[model samples]
Target chain A: MSAPTLPDLSGHFGRYGGRFVPEALVRALDELDAAYRTAKTDPEFQAQFKDLLLNYAGTPSLLYRAERLSARLGAEILLKREDLNHTGAHKVRNVLGQALLAKRMGKPRVIAETGAGQHGVASATAAALLDLECVVYMGETDTERQALNVARMRMLGATVVPVTNGSRTLKDALNEALRDWVASVDTTHYLLGTAAGPHPFPEIVRDFVGGIGIEARQQCLDQLGRLPDAVAACVGGGSNAIGIFHAFVPDESVQLYGFEAGGDGVATGRHAASITGGSSGVLHGARTYVLQDEDGQTVESHSISAGLDYPGVGPEHAWLHDTGRAEYEPVTDAEAMAAFQLLCRTEGIIPAIESAHALAGAARIVPALREELGRTPTIVVNLSGRGDKDVHTAGAYFGILDPVETLVPGENS
Target chain B: MSIAEIFAKARAEERALLIGCMPAGFPTVDDSIESMIAMHEAGCDVIEVELPYSDPVMDGPVIQKASDIALGRGVRTRDTLRIIEAVAGAGATVVLMTYWNPIEKYGVNAFARDLAAAGATGMITPDLIPDEAAEWIAASDEHRIDRTFLVSPSSTDERIAMTVAQCRGFVYATALMGVTGARTSVSSQAPDLVERVRHANPDMPVGVGLGVGNGAQAAEVAGFADGVIVGSALIRCVLDAPDRATGLSRLRALSAELAEGVRNPAK
Candidate 1:
């Protein structure tokens, strides 16, 4: 079979992705599209990107065999450890590439919208490294939830602006960031966090983050001597999943699963399962599956993981689901939390609640797979980030810290 | 009457047209309609009724806050149409300003039919452009509804020409490279952009928006452009008012001041 290619010249992934932004952003997007085209072919740009990945962000993250998880689930489970990367998530990979591209485009300032604050921290890290002025727009609620990451971004010299608009979450932050970009397009590059947004952004982010899939594909072959039966990743805006899913798209024998955050459950109408439970509509400059009411007004999505608390997914993910190239399912908050705690106890690896959704999804499918296959199947779950930032939330949810104890962490202990 | 007729009438009077914008159901549905009617009676030549969206990415903080209030109060597409119907019934040229998603969900043809039937003469889609607006273009043409497309300062000559060709009424010239808001100074790029749009299509009346606040700023924009569009400032007037009656009165006062400024450009 030939190689898998997507998002045609106009940035349509089978009618899913298009530039649905305002006229003010058209020229900037066009310029970005042209610059990315040039940068993609330029060997110097590629060399610089590779060097950063190797020495700075630390690419080729390990694919470890989760033996305990496999033994318990009756399937061979492998953990693609993206949590080990700089900034403790897969976000750094894309931020660095975009930061370098910004430099090449003669942009001196970088801005991004972050939800869980991982992308904000990662973008701030990239900006500090590149010496570009950085600003991050985060939802006010997110700043309160993910305080550590907010502090980390500020420490890295980024101005963290809290957005208190609609929903006060990722979607709202995205809106504010786009507003900033419209005003500052002359000197500021919007370091979009996910494989979403208008033309060139989805494609550009996917290419940069596709390193996860590229490295994982080779590492799986080297470690297991064969490809996994299925690869699962959590999907919010779907950057991390798309990152690892792109390289495997051409490999027809492999199955791809995207786990969306089911805040309560799809039936409860309080979930972020855009692909699973959403209808196709436009949001954040792309025509994708969005959680909207019958009138096309975007509905608020709830999730324990701030990163996955979005009403929309990447357009490519929508195309992938429509074309039957990939399957998307929801992992409820309870199920994801269980998997989060289980991974901590069994594998000694605490994952971001976002990544735990993938774990929960794999757990849900494994029992059925064992019954159907009559043999152990190999599964690789993308552990997209470490859980240090989520420890406070987890402690609260589990009631591990009392009210007085929570007041002072190290001091009380 | 068509948007061209409005501009032509303004030109005949030797004054740039003053276009007032306010979101539907802002503060409240009926109150918003009453406020817009008051502005129209005071001096607004054309009233642009904004269909408040869930995510208004193109709007500044003031408009965003107004839209949030509207949406929070349960304003929908049908309510916006109702507001437009009331405003148009009061003998003012009405145009609907909306983001694309709601229309896409509401069905382009259905929205066009409803908008036209409600007495709205035109539409200003902030997010939808000529390149990706084939559905809207066809629907608007079928309904004989004027379609106004935005042209930014950063637009290339080719882009300007393309947008001008698709525009049925005046081309919306975004005064600055930013989201919609009132500003102290008209962007230096506004005149150049208006010139570029004129060069592309001299017949197309150019309306400059996105930063015209008070009368002086309106006069500055009106000096070069055929129409002066005001939105955030009008919303702010109502937002800062002590009561609904005062808000409507303030909206009328601001509209009258801007209307006078458009007629008499500052030298």
Candidate 2:
């Protein structure tokens, strides 16, 4: 077979991907580009990483088949239990890899942009482990919604700066993070939450995330004697998808599907469906595809799930779609919410809204499997995190919880 | 080779796409299109028409204010596409330079088709990162719209080589470490930066932009680079002028001045 097309460093996946950063941050990027190459080869770093994942962060996270859900949906359901990860979610997996890379690069502090607070928590977790100063940029709005996460980051000794500018959301927080990074290019490393950003971030984060595929591929083979037919995951800056998609890319048999947040509906003016819907442009320092105006301003996105509400996606996804390696689709807010409730009832598993995108997509995929193949096929849905944190929003939507005015007895966290 | 031929002749000379900072719908869609026409008329390689966003942290005050005015005046994609059509009517090569959100809202493939139909040769969204380029780039390429990518000085030798290979038009070489602005001193390390680029790509023309102000700086940058890009300086000129003719004339004059500087950098 011909060699897989190597992704270029400008981060292009066949005309997508680029460094769209501020001028001040160029040196830092260059420094990172240089340090990452050296650090990747260091056995010491690898040994330390291996030790952390195995000991502190629980290596080889279990891939449990969702037998009941599979039977119910008429297709095999597998769970890549990233929830078993330390501090929950697959965000820590990336943070650990980057924080270690940062330590090797001799950076003083680690910076991050957070939405639902999972990334902030994970970054704080990594910083605490590595003894690095952590500064996580969170939007004021997000801080209000994910108050516990805000407090959690602070409790972990991280400085949480709420971004009050520009719609006061995740994207705005990202702008502030990039600004801080630009101002202090030398001493800080942006521990990006997802596989979005510029060249090295997409490539490096994907490398770190390949562990998921490695573990899952082996587990599937050991259990079922062959790789699963398809693997699906939620796309928020698309880290989980990258984590699951990397090892499977070379395996032509195992299909990869990434589900984006479609918000109220694709018909409505709300959603974060960048790959399935967005146009080509730049944001946060990479020229991939993003939701923007004809003038290049980032457009605001809406989703019931805050984590998957981001308007841009990773560049490699652009490459994948261009090359036809992976297929991306949007999962609407109602459908995701229904899936969220469905998972809670079916498997006693409450999933984060971002991960709910995968469940919602999987819900659709299950019915199609029976008609298409005439056999129930095994599939893995990366349960990225437990939905313990997003209970407030979930409760509000179903009217299970009260509005902000009068608090219930146990509502005061 | 001819200037237009150079841009078209991707194999020979490095194709450079020119992006101008003008408030969309400003001076009127007609005026904006005329400026695009003027850039093309004055031998600009490829036109990057910015859709002025209000909170453009990436841009300096000039482009930032232009973004505000354009966006504040409600210059939507429809208006910008009208401008693209007008520019194409003027027989100019054009592309859309914007952030990603609006395009995402518009739908990727539809946007690509609309842009290509409006006669846009390509797009330059500085913020659509590499990992997310799959849908937009793929759909656009299928529709025959080239996507331009940015390459910074901080980009490694390997990455620069990668960008030089992947990017369809010329590489946008940022001149300094800040947003686009007028600087008194041309980045002192510009010649060396140009030399470094030359070592990596002895072929492609690097468009030296950001921080370049006067003809002297332009000329100095031209000494080591292929083209001198003046954004804030020219935009500032248009904003300062009272009327359209004066602004257009000033734009032409600056273009000529910068071109002259490129020809004789020692001066």
**Candidate 2 residue runs with Cα over 4 Å from true position:** A1-5, A20-27, A280-282, A293-297, A403-413, B1-51, B54-57, B60-66, B76-176, B180-267
For every model shown, the clashing-pair count is 0, 46
Task: Tell me the native contact fraction for each prediction.
Answer: 0.86, 0.28
Question: Which 10 consecutive positions of candidate 1 chain A have the poorest summed lDDT?
Answer: A404-413
| CA shift of A59, model 2, Å | 2.6
Q: After superposition, how far is residue B249 of candidate 1 from its true place, in Å?
A: 1.4
Q: What is the TM-score of chain B alone in each candidate?
A: 0.98, 0.84
Model 2 alpha-carbon miss at residue B208, Å: 10
Per-residue alpha-carbon lDDT of model 1 for A236-338, expressed as tens digits? 9999999999899988888899999999999999999999989999999999999999879999998988889999999999999988889999999999999
Candidate 1: pairs in clash: none
CA lDDT of each prediction against the hidden true structure: 0.92, 0.76
lDDT of 2 by residue, A84-179 (tens): 788878777799999998998888799999988889999998999899999999989999988999999999999999977667889878877776
Estimate, for each residue in B89-120, the C-alpha lDDT of model 1 and write its tens digit.
Answer: 98999999999999999999999999999999
Q: Write the per-residue lDDT of candidate 2 for residues B23-72, one digit (tens) a residue.
A: 55665667777776776676555556876654455676577666656666
